[model samples]
Target: MWMLVNANGYTLAPDGGNFSALVMDGGQIVAVGATDDVRLQYGARVDRVYDAQGATVLPGFVDSHLHLAWLGMQMNMLDLARATSAEDVLAQVRQRASTLPSGAWVLGANWDENRIANRRMPSIAQLDRAAGGRPVMLRRVCGHVVFGNRYAYEQAGLGIHPANPSDGHFGRTPSGDIDGYAYEGATTLLERGIPAMSGSELERSIAAAIDSALASGITGVHSEDVRHVGSLYRTMDIYHRLQAQGKRLRVHQLVGFDALEEYGEWLVEQANKQPTIEELDWLETGAVKLFADGSLGGRTAFLQHPYHDAPTTRGTAIYTQEELNHRVAQVRKFGLPVAIHAIGDGALEIVLDAIASVPAVAQRDRVIHAEVASEPLIRRMAALCDRMIVDVQPRFAASDLPWVEGRLGLQRMPYVCAWKSMLNAGLYLCGGSDAPVEPIQPLLGIHAAITRRLPGTSGDGRFMNEGLTPYEAVKLFTHGPSYAIHREDRKGTIQSGWMADLTIVDTDISNSQQLEMIPRTCVLQTIVGGEIVYDRLR
Candidate 1:
């Protein structure tokens, strides 16, 4: 047994209080209480003890939504997210181009046109010059759009003038030539020409994400990987290997979204091949993922009305009402819970109606990015106990909220990120960083949730009244995710009989005055299953 003493701990219990010591043995917390008494009883037999040095400890963060594969992909790829202008991005691209073999693909991710000082999308001619004649592809931060160089267009077999898809688009110049821009599924055309990652390369990336998560004090993550990178078997293979190596991190993977016929067939084919487990403790999946719409940042999110800024057009819809209902019901027939990406209000209405149509087949069905749901939609979601959950990224506010108000206007801003209203309406809320989309750091998430402001930025919050309290905000990353996933009884809290996963920090979060420091708060230690996985002070 081991004890963590000389500190403050927030249990996230219904009847919350301060605890001084946390005692654990064999991957379970044995006791938690005042240091003097609990230590007096267990000190004699305790084999090891961690002195907190008067810091604040809490249950380790459990992020309910993120793409670990994508995060890993970003870690090793060309990152244009920080480039201040188009020229800066091109300068970096040229540097990369100088090193790669000619004709080899140059891939990049996280490029946002809005962040560029000129606010201009890079043109194909500019990209060609930057890549020095090599094929180049880069995805927008939202992953809904892509930019490619002339060589990439040539490799993809695109013609001089390419017609756009009915649901998505490709940019064209005044001369009617392909502009090397692709939106939505059209981006996949260019992607197909790129080489796929090797199995060992994928394992290395997943391993990278695991180490990053642990270092950030994350104990568990509800991740989506197979959809973007490789096959489900490939994704789970590395996870199983990690478990075999005794490197365990709680992961609830959501099956990738694809066409109804293909995804359905693959599910049954992989069922018998899946490795049997004593319980779904380390890695498990019973949830099927779907994409209902695009992202707000890309101006592709389905909305009832046209964007206030882009009044000429409303956002794109991945599926219509009937299409969604029919597909959702068919997916439910397989007995798998569904999680859909529904960012705009139009998508929410259709998704909620779809879930409502299906009689409760599972304990939880998730609404990823319920970013903009209206009042009536909230009420309807409350009625549906298909246990529909709202998986949100508060840090998204830090990024999107800055310009979302301009797109939505004041009349619509209040309804956006109305987390308080959703809770009052009896809807469940869980937090995720949508990492690589946002940083996967939970303290930054907590800061964003409570403050609704970008860390280090000085101003009134984007929507100050929509912000959550410190306790409520913390729950988004803790009990809220556990309950959403139906694992609350065993995880998500620091208490007796619960899983021994704790995150220790050097500051008090409950003080309210310390809220601004939440993002800056450093992780002193991360303990997972009674074992020290990450310790910075050491």
Candidate 2:
């Protein structure tokens, strides 16, 4: 029983038209038309009126992949994402350590070595000097690698040369000594020592992250937080509690692969109870999240060919083909889809093979971050697109495009971050931020999707042909998500009978030139399910 007027609305429907007004009742859109006509028709019954002030209104943005608790934790952790040199990182670590007690751990995240002046991770000795005996662990921007000081290793209950994980390794000196650098599975060695957040802390962190997301115009997120909270039960409990407390952020919770057994047990409990209608709308179980490989920036994404920049390595694979197949089968037994993180073509190939081997799981799988792929891989992926979803982080192009060509070579450049190609080949793509790794703003993702370049940069972007049109780019966060989650009939558009989830912004993004303004656009209001969850004016 509310109305929004003065909006430059992009219905994103068939024939693609604009409307100025919309009506909602009982959390569903009831009507949409010219502002005067709708206002005249519904004026008597409407209990509230929202003035958009001629701003643009589109479908609510949904982040297809992210870690909720971890993103919230990053809000309080040391931010090294902007550091430009090794010295800058060391200086920040020193400053953070100075504020903490002598033996307390100083944890930080999101430091990219490629952006540093030296183009290298700082040594353990350098970290030790900066930390001044305090335990310190700094995660690389990719989150697959971590560099720690001596005190950190000791505090983590590890010796100078702890056993390397079966799935990953520890960086070693020329003479074979541990170098305080852990990659892939080895990162758990350091993480196990970092104290776990209590239930209240986790709830606060999730709330803070949701506030940030809603402010950025995101109405929904498919979050993976089981590992961050240290227990699947705790993570699900917090989300359920938050929903009952009237939090508007819609969360599609993805259980981690390690917690598959727990998820199965939880499913039995769910079967015995009837969830309320509000609970169904606010929170729902998603697929089991699995990592097939690491990240491109960390040189750990399993590639078909060795890296051009670093010829000695072809990147690390978290699981062999046989193992991945086994895990997918296990998830199938629980009757849940699998969302596997596979960035490079090598990992994608293995994942495709695994899916192809399991006939029952073929179209039900989700490939997260297919950042690098060849023609054959795309074709293979398209074959399963009947129900399969490819979850992509559009913002990654803005950050990774500058150096991805160097990691991969000119020959592979055409296939890297090729979104348009995938779309043209009939693949269903859903956009995300991978926040704490990238910013959570959906507009930033839209900007990157259209420009294929950094926000302020000019000229043709790298692989400009691979870029999507403004409307197509916007769809990645809008209709794309609804399609991915099988809610197209009720969400993703502003038509009557659809769910009333709308993102109102300051920019009218209808064409290519207007895309430049997206990076600077401010979200005026975020309305989810007929409720104004975030309003800048208020």
Candidate 3:
């Protein structure tokens, strides 16, 4: 019942023919053609009209990976994502601590030490000073390490000294007293003690996250939030409620292994009854996630070779090949899409071998990071594209660059962020922000992809050989992701049969000149299913 006209938008074709108008009715695109052509058919019945005002219009972005509940929790908690030094982080903690009652837990994340002057984590004594006798649980930028204050240790019932336990370690003082840093499973001590969000609180977090995503022009996200929030059933119930209440953002939920183990029978029943994706829907849950290894920054990623910087240790592998293969087979048999974290080449090979052990399926089993993919793996993955995909974060260049060559060294540098290589290898390359890890802005990721360098910095990129064109980068967010989720038929483009999930930007993003300033180009409006979900102009 609406028409959008006079936009400098493309139909997303190879030639990208100029289009002047679009028609929408019943929350779907009815027609797209010249202004007169669209009006000739629906002129009399159209209830409202909108003008693009000469801005660029494209498909709404899809973040192939991210954590929503964590994003929402960060919104409610203190944010030290921008802290550049240990003192700066302590200062932020001290400020937040002053407002809280004594013994309250201070929670936040996105703490990157690379930006710090000395690039060192703050000590427990410093955190104690900043936290004012309160418990503090701050996740590192990588999410693999958790920093806690003395009160956190006290609350966990561990005395002044705690040793390495289970699959993780705690940094201890020379005298054997517990330090702030906890790694891998050891961080669970702090997390397990934190209170879970109430039902109402979870709803609020989901709503806040949806609004934020819409404002960023993200119509869809593949979210892994079960462990970050609570039970899978509870989260799904909340999503259903939000959908019934008319939430617009599309959600592709990633079920945790724990959730599958706990509620396998119930989930199987629900999957059978899940609605078809013939039309654009608000929420769907049919994906399973497994962690193959830790993170590059955390130095726990399972590398085939020892890290150049840390040659003494290779890293952690959460599951053996047999174990991972068994889990993959189980999920595949249950008709669930699976995505495994594989940052290092060692982890990538394991996932590939496991998937290759079984016949190919169209479920789009994926290697989530594959950051350190090798030539052989690339070739094999290309041969397996009919069954698998690679979901990568372009903005990782911003964080990993300047040091990637140090950790990965020269031989592996070419393979890192080799999106074009992935494409050439016949792999579908979807992009994401990995928000809370990287900023959730689609433009930021695009800028990183097209430039492979931080904004405002010099040169084509640190790795100019690895850069992707602006159009190709955009497609990673649109076409690539759509294909990965089996919605390429209707979700990723601006065609007559496609859903009317469109994003309007203030500038022409495809222009190479604009790539330099793309991060500054704001989302003028985000339309989902022909309804305006976010409108800066309004």
Candidate 4:
């Protein structure tokens, strides 16, 4: 049966003119043109007609980078994101401690040292007092560092003495005692005590993440939580069952590089077992993700110069160039794409070199969080053209802008978040919210790209000169990401023979002034593969 969808405004194709109506049959767009033309073609045989009621319909958002399972787990954990001071963090910890078992591990995330009143890392004594000797680990907002209580340190069998702190350091006092601040490798000490989620719990979390994305107008995402690999298989099974009963959401999974050794053989075997396309348009494996360095927030982003705040120290590198090159070569040999986490200038250079080493045929090599790329590297990236994809988070400008200027200094600030440069260089730009790091809402990201200002700030907007137009921002979240994952032929734009994945909003977002109000605009509906998975009106 055919479905005719008529709207007041819509972008029918990336380069084509807007249209008033579209027709879908068998989960694929059959035609996109005038309402009269669509109605005349399928008016009599149409199973249903959807009126957009003047909303602006466009391609559904594609979040190319995110950890869906972890975001779900965050919903149940103690949220320290709102804690404004060290005292506030301790108070929340103490309040939650009273209800838990005496020896239970207290794990929480989303705390920033810059936001805390003290402007300093939390101490072991402070966490110990709050938790009453229970093992506790609170991750910084960046997820690259952790603050642990004395009990956690003891449980992990770590001593006060720093063990080759260069790799990652444990915060210590003048007298050589653990101060609870764990940077880099030191964070692993607390990971041992955190309990793993059951299969059912994992499925629930994945469902919650999907629902959350739908509400935010995110129809699809490329997930990177390898820790939940088992959970992914379980979630896929559950999704298959749900679809059999007629329900499911679209998802694309990417395995992390760390698990490549343990699961590489399995993925190679399962690649042949992939279900037919008709059975599932909602999930697929697109790439292998690798981390080249840590995060900017932790000052471990692997840079050429020392951190502005910590002049004595440059950032840390998670993997050597030789190791990364070997891994990329191995993964490329399997015909799978590779996406590397690279935030700093030095890290980006290394990843780019590794890509250069790969054969030209092995394309779609992505650099996630290409936040601080240099001009030379941008030129090198341009040479790859469509082969190189950049997965960037625009929302970071609002949260990290305050500290970014100080980190890179005024001279280098202009080069940061170089979206315009990438576009000018002819490279594909894929926008994403590394959710749990930033909120998963695409509009927030759109707002960031167009505004380039921190929340509640009135100053000449930070990097206002570098901001992108609303149309470009929307394209980044839509066609750009689809091209990144090599799915532009099937997803991305609303054209004939393409998957009917789309989002409808109340306002015209192409205008810059209109973008400021995007967050308030309602997502009237989200359709995936011709199925009305999320409809606000209903």
Candidate lDDT values, in order? 0.83, 0.87, 0.82, 0.78
TM-score of each: 0.95, 0.97, 0.95, 0.94
Which candidate, 2 or 3, would have the higher TM-score against the true structure?
2
Question: Top model by TM-score, which number?
Answer: 2
Per-model tally of clashing residue pairs: 0, 0, 0, 0
Candidate 3 lDDT by residue in tens digits, 1-538:
8999888886675545668889887768888888888888888889988988788888888999998887877788767777888888888888888999987788878787777778887888999888989889989878888888888888887657776675677878888788788887788776776767798898888888888899999988889988876788788788878877877888888888778775577666666777566432567665689888888888888899999888987788878899988988887776677888888889888888888887656668888978888788899889888888899999988668777787767877877877777887778889998887888888899899888888888776766767888878999888878888788887788888688899899989989866777989999999888889899988
Off by over 4 Å in 1: 259-279
Q: What is the lDDT of residue 361 in candidate 3?
A: 64
Q: Which ten residues in a row have the lowest lDDT in candidate 3?
A: 277-286
- Looking at candidate 1, the ten consecutive residues that score lowest on lDDT are 256-265
> Which pairs of residues collide in model 3?
none
lDDT of 4 by residue, 440-478 (tens): 988888888878875445555577767888878898788
Write the candidate numbers in order of decreasing lDDT. Answer: 2, 1, 3, 4
- Could you tell me how far off, in angstroms, the CA of residue 94 lies in candidate 4 after the best superposition? 1.1
lDDT by residue (20-43, candidate 2, tens digit) is 999999989999999999999998
